[model samples]
Target: MKPITMLALACLALSGCKNEEPAASVPSVELRGRLEVDQEKTSARQAQGIEGEYFRRVLTVDGSDMTLDAFINHYCPADTRDETCQKALRIKKIDDVSGATRFLPQGL
Candidate 1:
């Protein structure tokens, strides 16, 4: 065996035996409640014939409450040409909206 090959094998063996510390755990964000849009503002924009509806919603993350603007695509459905058929075809929520607490994080 070559002297360089022996030295490389020895270095590799020593590196494998070295102790490695465990990685630090990352803090996770606990989103416990549903975030909803402000209906009053959304309706106001819809009344003004805005194709892209921009609205604000309040979300509390990591004990801090902040307002965020979200946009939704509003247009007449392809199957219908009526103006009243125009709507924002986004699935806003999946779960029940009633009887849910707001802005409360888990574990107090």
Candidate 2:
């Protein structure tokens, strides 16, 4: 009886260890946006990574033509008027203009 009880406890613990996070599907399209005047490329990526709380590849944007620093300033300002836009401004490198970039929250 003792062994059975211990086994049950172990099983419960093991089951709890399973990854509970929902599996977020990778984005099929690319993301895009021009940097705001006050932000730079590197700063933008750093901000995005921090905001997302994970290193997501899709978050990285390329061919921005706009620096990360400039975007941060114009879009992600300290006194952002729009909380929705502020939350939406995630970290990412512009990959391709052909499609839209995907943003997935890892819930980290």
Measured over all alpha carbons after superposition, the RMSD of each candidate to the real structure, in angstroms, is 15.7, 15.9
Cα lDDT tens digits, model 2, 1-108, are: 999999999999999999776633322223233322223444575676733222223223343343333444444546554543343444332322212234345521
Sliding window of 10 residues with minimal summed lDDT for model 2: 92-101
Per-residue lDDT tens digits of candidate 1, residues 14-72? Answer: 98997976533222323232455557655776798755434334435457664321211
lDDT of each: 0.40, 0.41
lDDT of model 2, residue 8? 100
TM-score of each: 0.23, 0.23
lDDT of 1 at 95: 16
